[model samples]
Target: MANYFRDYADLCFEAFGDRVKHWITFSDPRAHAQAWHSYNSTWRGKQRGLVGISLNCDWGEPMDISSPKDIEAAERYLQFCLGWFANPIYAGDYPQVMKDRIGKKSAEQGLDMSRLPVFSLQEKSYIKGTSDFLGLGHFTTRYITERNYPSRQGPSYHNDRDLVELVDPNWPDLGSTWPQSVPWGFRRLLHFAQTQYGNPPIYVTENGASQKLHCTQLCDEWRIQYLKGYINEMLKEPLLSHMQMVTEIVVPTVCTLCILISAVLLMLLLQSQS
Candidate 1:
C-alpha cells in the first residue's frame, strides 16, 4: 500500500511539482510516512513542494477531572484516537497505554501476540519524523470515564479502550447525528498536541459546527456562535498565536465537515445572507 502511494506521488510530483506547493494525503500513518520518505529521497531536492497528512480527532475531556481514573480514561481516549497515528509520527511507536492494554486483551483472548501491529526497531526509525507539518482536524469534545469492558466481550475497538464517552446534557445539541457544541475541547486538544509532539506546525484544516436546514437559510446566528466559540478557544492556545501561521476557516459544503474563513468573513456571510 505504501509503495503504491509512493509511486503515485512520484508521478504527481513529476507532472505538476511546479504548481502544487502543498500536498496533503489521507492515509494510515505508516503509508503516509513512506510517502514522505519517497518525497525526500526522490524529488524533494527539486520538487519544491511540502507533503503532510491530515489526522482528525476530537478532544476527550475527563468526566471528572479530579478523578485519577477518569483522567486516565480521557488520556486513553486520545491515545486510541489521535495518538493511534500521531504516536508513530512523533514518538516512533504506538502509545504505551495502547501496547499494554491491547497486549493484555490479546493475552485474555489466548493470542500469543498483541492485536495491534508491532513496528520493528528499524521500521520505527524509518517512520519517525516523517511529517513536515501536522494537519489536524478537530471539532467538539467528549466527556470520558473509565469502563472495564470485559475481554470476554470479544475483540473490538471500543471494547479495547475500556472507557465510556458521555456528553454534558446541558451542552447544545446540534442533532442526534451532530456532535454537541463544546468549544473548550478545542483548546485542550491543541495543548495536548503541542505538549505531546513538541509543537509541530499545526494547520487547523477543519473546525466548525452543523446547523439544521431551514426554509429561510439566511440567518444562522447559531452557527456563527459556534464558529466564534471554537475560534475563540483556538486563539487562546499560546502555540497557535506564537507562530506566523494562516488561520483559515472554510464552511463545509456538507456542514458536518467544515471550517472558518475568519470572524470577519463569517459576519460578511451572515450579512450577505440577510
Candidate 2:
C-alpha cells in the first residue's frame, strides 16, 4: 500500500483523467499532496476536474458538561477528530496543538513521525482547494473530554487522537452496540462541517441505523423514528445533498418459508370451506 501510494499518481492521472469529473483522493492531504501534487498542479491548467479525499468523521456530544472545562474539552475533542482531518485539506496543516501533543507522545510510542502525518510545502499548496467536494462519511457520535483523552498506548483510533469518550444519554441503544441515537448530533455535525470547511459540497457516503430483533411481530418503530429525525436534519438545506441510501437487510430463509407454507395452508382451508 505504501509503495502504491508512492507511485500510483501518474498512472491514475493518465488512466482516469478522461472519464473522471472529480477525484476523491486520500484521507491525509499531506500524503495526497506527496502523491498527486505533480498531476494536480498542472491538471487544472489542462482543464482537468479537481480531486479531494473523503475523510471519516464521527460527530458527537459530551456526556458530562457541567464544567466549563468539559465544554472546551468537548469542542477540542471534536476539533481534533473531525477538524484535524478537514483543516489540512483547507488550511494546509494539522492543528498546531495536535502536532505538539502527538510530538510529545511519539517518543514513548516509538512512532517514526508524529502519528498525525507530515505535509510538504508543495503538497500543502497542491492540496489546498484540491477538493471539488468534501466527502464526509459519518457513522456515530462520541462524548469527549480532556481527562478521557488517552495516550498512544491506547488501542482505539480515537484514544490515539487523545480524546476522552462519552455517549448521548437520551440516544436509543438499538441497532449496534456502539451507536446511540443522537439524531440531533447529526444536524450539529453537518453545521460544524459547513462552518469549518468552507461549506464545500458534502457527499455523505454512509448514514443509517443497525437492526434490532428480527420478527414480523417485532415493530421497527425505533428505527423508523431514528430515520425521520436524521433525514429531517440532513435535508434542512436544499443544496446540501449527496448519496442515495442503499439499505441492506437479511430476511431469514426460515421466515420466507414460513410465509409460503402459511399461504398454501390458508388457500387449502378456504377451498375446502367453499
Candidate 3:
C-alpha cells in the first residue's frame, strides 16, 4: 500500500496533469499527504478538476439495540471507518480520538520515525479542503456489538475498536453473505456522512447487488427481480437522488421458444437448398 501510494504520486506528475482530472490517492492520508500534495501543482490548470481519496465506509448500527455499550460501539465504528478519510480531506488531520488509540502502537511498529506521517504546516494548510467531493462506497449496514479486546491481533487499529458484526437474516437478502439489503441503513449512513463531514457533496462511487445463483432452467428471473426490488428501495432514500445504479454485466439469456423456432427455420432452409 505504501509503495503504491508513492507510485501514484510519481505517475500523477508524469501524466503532466493533462490526462487526469479527479485524482484519488489510495494510501494512508496522514502518512502520505506530502507526496500527494506535491502532485497538486504538477497537474494544476490542466483542466484537472479535483483530487481526493476514495473511502470505504461502514454504516454501522447496534445489534443489541437496547444496549448502551453496543450503541456507542456502533457510533465509534462508523467514526473510525469514515472519519479516517474525512479527517484528512476536511480537517487536515487524523481524527484526534483515533490517534490517541492506535498512534502509539503504530509508532512502535517501525513507524516510530513517522507513525502518522507528518504534514508540514504549509502541506496541512494546502491539503485542508483539497477534496472536490467525498466519494463514499457503501454496500450494507452491519449491526455492531461491543466486545472485549480481540485475542492478540497485535495492536491493530480495527482490533482496538472491538467491534463484532452481527447480521440480520430478516433484512431482505438480495443474496450475498456480506450485504443484506438494509435500505433504511443506507439512509442512516448518508445522514451520518452529512452530519460528520459538514455535509460535503458526496458521490456514490459504487453501489450494486450480487446474488449467488445457479442456473436450473437457465432463466435469470431471480437476478432481474433482485435488481428491480433493490433499486426501488435505493431510490426511496432522498440522499441517493443523485445516485446512479449500474447493473453488472449480464449475459443475455437465450429464450427456449426463440431457439426452437430458429432451429426449425434452419432445417426448412437446408431442405430447400438441397
Candidate 4:
C-alpha cells in the first residue's frame, strides 16, 4: 500500500516538484511516511522540497482548573485528538496517557492486546522525524471534564477518552453547536504544538469559518472578527519564543548594573551631605 502510494507520489514529484516547495502526501501518516521516505531517499537531492502532514485539532480547555480530574481529562482530550496522528510522526508512538488508559480499558474488556496500534523500535525510528514541518488547523476550544462510562459499553475510540466536552454559553455559535468562535483557543493549541513537537516550523493549514448561515450581500462581520482575533492570537507567539534566550542574557546584566549604579549614587549623595 505504501509503495503503491509512493509510485503516485514519485509521479507527482517528477511532474511538479520543481514548482511545489511543500507537499502534504495525501491523508494519514502511513502514506505520509512512505512519501517522506521516497522524497528524502530519491527526489530530495534534486527536487529540494518539504513533506509534512496537516492536523486539525481543537484546544481542550479544562472546565474547572482547580479540579485534578478536569485537568487530566483536558490533557487526555488533546492527547487523543492531536496526538492520535501527530504522536507517531513526531514522537514515535501514541501518547503515554492514551496507551495507559486504552490498554486498561481493553484489559477490562478481556482483550489480550491493546486496541491502540503499537510501533516497533525500527518502525518508530522510521516514523519519527518524517515531517519537515507541522501543518496545523485550529479554530475553537472545548471545556473538558472527566466522565467514566460503564465498562459494558464495548470497545470504541470515542468512549476511550472518558471525558465530557462543554462550551461557554456566551461564545458565538457558527451554525453547528460544535465549533464556537473561541479565538483564544487558537493560541493555546499553537503553544501546545510548539511544546509537544519541539518547536517545529508550523504552517496553519486551515483556519477561519465559513459563512454557512447567510451570504446575501457578501457581508461577513463574524468572519472578519474571527480572522482578526485568531490571527492576532497566532501572531502573538514570537514574543515568547527564541526571544527567551536574548532576554535571559540581557535582563540580569542590566539589573546588576542598575543596582551597582544606584548604590554608588547613594554613597556619593551621603558624602556630599557630610
Off by over 4 Å in 3: 1-21, 27-42, 103-123, 148-152, 211-274
Q: Record all residue pairs in model 2 with backbone atoms less than 3 Å apart, i.e. clashing.
A: 25-52, 148-164, 149-164
User: What TM-score against the true fold does each predicted structure earn?
Assistant: 0.82, 0.66, 0.66, 0.88
For 86-119, candidate 1 gives per-residue lDDT tens digits of 8898999999999999999899889999999999
Candidate 4 Cα lDDT to native: 0.87
Q: After superposition, how far is residue 134 of candidate 1 from its true place, in Å?
A: 0.5
Name the best candidate (by lDDT): 4
- For each candidate in the order shown, give its overall lDDT on alpha carbons: 0.83, 0.68, 0.67, 0.87
Candidate closer to the true structure by TM-score (higher is better), 2 or 4: 4
Stretches of candidate 4 off by over 4 Å are 148-152, 175-178, 214-217, 246-248, 251-274
Question: For candidate 2, which ten residues in a row score worst on lDDT?
Answer: 241-250
lDDT of 2 by residue, 48-167 (tens): 676667777677566566877667666767767777867776788777767776776775678777666788888677656656677776667778665743354553445545556777
Residues 154-255 of candidate 4: C-alpha lDDT, one tens digit per residue: 678778999898889999866654568998889989989998889999999888787656456777777788889999998998766867756888888899
- Worst lDDT run of 10 residues, candidate 3, spans 244-253
Between prediction 1 and prediction 3, which has the larger lDDT? 1
Q: TM-score order of candidates, best first?
A: 4, 1, 2, 3
lDDT of 2: 0.68
Prediction 2 TM-score vs. true? 0.66
Error of 3 at 263 (Å): 86
Off by over 4 Å in 2: 1-3, 6-17, 26-30, 34-48, 64-66, 106-123, 148-163, 213-224, 237-274
